[model samples]
Target: MASSVSAAAKASAAFAHKKELAAAAPAPTQHRAGSGRRSKPCRVRAVASPARAPRAPSSTGSVKTAMTMTEKILARASERAGLEPGENVWVDVDVLMTHDVCGPGTIGIFKKEFGGDAKVWDREKVVIIPDHYIFTSDERANRNVDILRDFCMEQNIKYFYDIKDLSNFKANPDYKGVCHVALAQEGHCRPGEVLLGTDSHTCNAGAFGQFATGIGNTDAGFVLGTGKALLKVPPTIRFVLDGEMPPYLLAKDLILQIIGEISVSGATYKSMEFVGSTVESLNMEERMTLCNMVIEAGGKNGVVPADETTFKYLEGKTSVDYEPVYSDAQARFFSDYRFDVSKLEPVVAKPHSPDNRALARECKDVKIDRVYIGSCTGGKTEDFLAAAKVFLASGKKVKVPTFLVPATQKVWMDLYSLPVPGSGGKTCSQIFEEAGCDTPASPSCGACLGGPRDTYARMNEPMVCVSTTNRNFPGRMGHKEGQIYLASPYTAAASALTGYVTDPRDFLM
Candidate 1:
């Protein structure tokens, strides 16, 4: 453990030295011609100095303070030497993302406050993605996208992922579905940066070791007029998850367990930092799943410190240089909790609340009418792979109707292109077809947000559904009386096969 901590300190120092050298060098003059836009120069900020040993004395004869990853990132973004919880600071925004659901309202506020002729603080910093309300006949929903497109064109926003053809998603090459997934896929989520989005799930990017959180339309408008936001530094709750994860469990199950332990309002306005061996073993997608539902616990943000796994995932995704930060060995926390993941089992959130948790095996008698496997939380490539693994193991058709919606166009393509690890070269598409599940729909936030009356696979009647979505509240998926059970992809697939809330262990073991 001591050796590992020393290695981390050395790595952080090396990154700081590299950043300093890069700052002193001349800027490159290359343009992203493929996207018809010029790449922006890396903006240098005050880099946090390498942390000292726990309780070590400083040159001034005072004990140096230890900072958490969240605090260090905020300090750099706010251009401060150090910061503590509850301190209000003005942080420079690295990325400001807005989607169709909140874009129109944010734009309205921007125009009303900054004037119609006033230009945005930075065109390239703003990302407008039209994910929700697409693939629907709702005139108002269609109008929302038009409003976003007009605004992007007027502002010359370079990162607008627009979808024009509602009939077929393939016709729109620039379209990327689901803003959170699209943000990470398109290289907007860099380590040690500050990202504020109009949607609550923006915290998903925290998996990349960044400070990401949601903002209201008014806050977004302020960010549009000025590339800065005044935010309070949040006290962080440390969660240490040790031991190897069980085969029947996934990141979704782990997060559900945490939320269940602490309730929905437990982490209100607090940063939730996940660490330990279990987290380090998770892939980038699994780490994303862990951070995606922090908002469900009313957390201000969720973060996993960047490591080689994070750097590897960002290698081809982003061209921008970034320096990752880590929490000091003695970093202070508001509270701490520890869990042994190997001893845990599959769990789910019952209807009416996200924190209403129960063991999947205990709820085996609960009959489900349908199953859904989609949304930013559970619709990534790994998610579908996990589901297909269950179906492949069971070797049986689903008793209930199963719906699959990939979160993004890239994820959709991956479903068809990538092969399941041990399925005799069979892909997720083939497995879904063999299981008699519905054909994978075009990538979007389909049925997750209950967009319209005609939404594909939406529950219009009072039906019980076992879903991989984050929320299980009444009417979260469709009808107010409809019951939704939030579970892991593995559990959802197993339940679909039996038409009951079944535990994945029944098949995996």
Candidate 2:
């Protein structure tokens, strides 16, 4: 069985790398009409029928109202001429997603309210993925996935990513790990669309220039019965990030800095709109990382205006056409904050809170027992590449245990395939192996949410750990007494080498 799993992983790695290489080629040029603005929104040709396409902003009289991207998306989804902040509106849902942890409960609610015999409004638009607790011996955890499988089969859901074999993840080719990453990878995320999931990090999809947020089970049930949801338009808080990103700073640091500036509840019930040269410079995955933790800062959703980079990432990922929107030049903002990326340094959130920020260098004396590199926030292909770069540069074996969990199967494959730039020809997997780190485990949301007691890499003891995952609340990763320092992949890897909270610049420089 072990041999078969190994062989399957190897074969898939080779095949996945070929596709990655093809995708690495330069994207086609996207022409744009310059409006003399600092940021120009990319015009997307709508492929959906006229009814499905959002109505263009009205241009009837001399007076016109400016709308932010969040307001514009809500207006289109609700079929309104215009909308204002704090207004309750019934909006059309582009996609409804549920997963193992919440799927069973959401399913129960849907049946209770809509009747078991009633069919979903749109089977094609609902996405179900089982990721949270797939790799465990706990019966209840395993049963949760079974519930999702039966529900998906009964509903005839078109986009259900399921896994039946717990022993060998490679056996389940249909299964994609981690709900947030899987959603984007499977092409369910598109620009100018409304996406609601049972998970809070659903806001991660907003990075694609969409209105994506989390909804309760009851709200999800309502959307299940009818393809519409009653939502309130949130006021916009504009964050302008300028200057080139420093070598040591990743999107994780930028977001950590933002959260530290504004307390966890600072942006409560408001849309956080990220703009400016620095934001535009980020790739899709980096943008996703930036938006993923907005819920921690009490944000409604986070959006980056769609441009060439956004179009490039979605090229082969989706066949459905989407209309990307942007904030009007005169858009009203509840508040505006500006940041200079060049001035920022690598930072981490101390244990027990995502807002407890501190510089990496400040925590150098803090010893760590383990270093974790995975989660929707830091477990992408590029994230692993960054960690590998650090490890290769350090040229030292880890002094502490370093656990690796890829967010999805594709990432798992990439670890074994994608070569690290400037590392000769070494892949991330090879670098990790040489660094004395644990072999990258099967892709899943392992230990991020502190699943079943038997979960791999669970913090069973009261030890300090440097982790790339988000959230460091009490017992977030496992033991209540465990201390977790939330950090970027580079910092996590550097800490692993020294068994202390070391800054990546120590090695990178």
Candidate 3:
């Protein structure tokens, strides 16, 4: 019995000794594993939660008391309050937009990488719009649409706005006109959110004070699998446009002039924030037009802070709870420039590049073969009305074959009762119908992409085309031999009347 007790005492003492040694150990295995080799180890913590963390300092020496529009959106997306420009952060994506042009390729890569049966990160976050090549009779285009339709069906995504929604709105209650417009109008793009689209003009949604930009198919495929994207917070260039009223000039003229002055690469990879009395004077549709062409200027995005116009547009359209973000009064900017719109004149982008611009009246002698008055940049009801006033004032037939493609079905629907800008005797719908302008059945990207079976007005022969679309690059409108001139809808209508590039003011007087 004494021997048994002694053995038990020895075993208990050994265990107590082990406990002391463990308590006196230098550190845990994990804590000391890489500390001996390298001080900084790639240790990953738990997956990032949506709860915001403490804000880091801004790139500038100033401690940012308030965030800019871009900063707020990115910070919130990355689950942090403060973000410095040029720092790459992993951001949660609010919307992943894929159109017919890039949706198939994105889907192909997504399936190949994630496996066919692998589910998307967030099915409802994926938005598919088959607008780029839908009007074609080509089998491949149809197949592309079918792929998107099938994928959305399999994923049970509710945001896929397909061709049926183009005409039969009842078929899909979530129909929108264009991807950019649909994004905002349908409440997908909210302030303080991150929205990425497959097309460059995705910047258009930035008009609502959101962080919206374009990504290629590979990046989109990754976002499809994981609802996250690495973003380098972009520095913003603030443009202050304080000016008196100008009769002839519109938002298109202002943007054209800005592009001409900045060159296409001036704001490369940077955000262009439009501010001042002029931009504030614009309505939501006009602000969208201003932001849509930022891609042409090589900007990461173009934004206008949330204002009354923006607030009103989103009021009834969005039921999604969202916090509105704006640039602090003392927001830090990479560069700042001011322009007086009162001194600005009507402008047009010459052939080859969007930055190659000239005053509209200066290029009046330049002849045109066709006039296109539609695209995301110039398809709104306001654009149509602005153009209609010129046609009504002329009371003349269109000298050139003009094409009017409304930006969205809603814009098209509103056109039935559009008044001429000056409240002239006739409606815009009547003016276009009487002017021999060809109107497509539904609103779409149309000829913006110059896809196969090319929609309405494409260059069949080498000709000078004055268009209201955003870009004017070589072969942008289907013909390398064809030259394109970009202008406002008002300017385009005046040019269509004279069969040459003319200033709308000349006709207005």
Candidate 4:
């Protein structure tokens, strides 16, 4: 960890003060989650039932639209466990993921709740990722890692990534990132399976057609306690997208638009089924980024119907034989909306809130000081490519102090080998080096969270910047004074090149 910047550092002095930015962040959105007029309470069963069955299996002998990804997984897992949807029956979990901060707490809870040795029903099924506090800026966190280390050693858990990568303790070797990305990359997530984790982003695994969701510490404790947790079949909502996304817009833009439309908690307890040609056009990486942020929209989870893109990504990786699942055409959906992406513009979410979004062009004049290009949400190969495209095209050195951290070591290795497209003499590393940007690639959330050596400095300085990360909440990316605009990698790269908040579209123009 570099001692150059402290976690308390504020954004640049030229930007808004912390108090003012914080004020803008908490401004209530028009469509606050859970604030909508209550429609009559529809039974979960009623919502799950289809109006009609498939006429017959298709040529591929697969059901494209039968039940939603979430519905199918819950139904199958229930059948295997002799339960039914909406029965609230506790069933076996196909996978369990934990991070350091909550990992130790879950262990203690598991011992107390189950009243036995620290024994998980299946050691291999459990993945322990020590990302959050792995850097251990505090003495208590260090102690917690010791406890987690001892527990993993005792249980013979195979997936454990420690803090040596980037100072964040959650940086484990076998575990690359937030348990969600690690599971997806490592083939731990499979179609039609039930997965639970301690982190909210665990819903990210839903991209692979799994019924993955997050739970509270107590809930996770119960899972480890009994190797199972009860789930009520969630209703499904569908987003039918159309048209091609503009150059500046990507999966992140689509999700931000949805979050703005629905507010943070719109989907509350409903599963999101992403259908439409636009969704099909998205690669697995983009789909995963979309599903990864569903929790932010208050969806139980999000899903993209398994397609060739999904199968190709998972075919060789999954140890378990892979069978794709798709929502039925006549599948019951609680609500649905169609999005036209062709006309969509780059969107930005004002801080202290993710749902506070508007067209990026509307805020183009906003000045920026720092540009961040990493996070579980934005730290993928595709994301890096998008950012690199902007940087290469600009031919401008990074005007501000910029940083690029890989979401995981694996991602770093995958992207690091590739050369910067326009830099005839430079690789990605060389490009960042020339621009005076710090390029640190390693495991886990290195600088996003207010972990030591990666935190914000200068408490109330007003600074604006683009970030490729989830959540622009109050004090989320560091100082409350800094104005953080959540954007895609392209936007971040553009800002890094110009030293201000410049939309990628402008460069296209």
User: Best candidate per TM-score, number?
Assistant: 1
Regions more than 4 Å wrong, model 2: 1-63
For each candidate, give its TM-score against the true structure: 0.90, 0.89, 0.85, 0.82
**Candidate 3 or 2, higher TM-score:** 2
Q: Which lDDT tens digits does candidate 2 get at residues 222-310?
A: 99999999998888877778889998889999898888767677677888888878888999999999999888888889998877787
TM-score quality measure for candidate 3: 0.85
| Deviation (Å) of 387 in candidate 2 | 0.5
Pairs with backbone N, CA or C atoms under 3 Å apart (clashes), candidate 2? none
For lDDT, candidate 1 versus 4, the one ahead is: 1
What digit string (tens of lDDT, one per residue) describes model 1 on residues 1-509? 01111111122110121211011121111111122111432332343334444544665565445567788889889988678888999999999999999999999999999998989999989999999889889999999999999999999999999998889998899999989999999989987799999999999999988999999999999999999999988877777787889899999999998887777877788888888889989998999999999988888999998767777777678877676666655567776666788888899999978889899999999999999999999999999999999999999999999999999999999999999989999999999999989999988888886778988889999999999988878788889999999999999999999999999999999
* Residue 486 in candidate 3, Cα distance off native in Å: 0.3
Find the 10 residues in a row with the least total lDDT in model 2.
1-10
All candidates' lDDT scores? 0.85, 0.84, 0.76, 0.68
* Model 4 whole-model lDDT (C-alpha atoms): 0.68
Per-residue CA lDDT of candidate 3, range 1-509, in tens? 01111111122110121211011111101211111222232321221222233564454343534445787678888877577778899999988999888999999999999999978889888988877766666778879989999999998887888675333543554555578877766778765568999999999998877889999999999999999999888877777776764767778987887787777776677888887788878888888888998887778998887656766677667666565566654456766666777877899999888889798989989989999888888888888888887887787888988988777777777687655656555677888888777753467777765767556566667789999999888888888788899999889999999999999997788
The candidate that achieves the highest lDDT relative to the unseen native structure: 1
| Candidate 4 lDDT by residue in tens digits, 1-509 | 11111211233221221211021111111111121122321212212333333355455454433455577677666653122224465557888888877888898888887775758777887888776655435777677777777888888887665554444323444556555666788878876678899888888888877788988888888876567888877767667777877777889988988777767876777788777778878888898889988888887788876655665677567666444445544455656565777877788887767878877777777778888887789887778878777766766788877777677667776666776656674566665666567765554565565465433321134567578888877666666677788888887887777776777876755
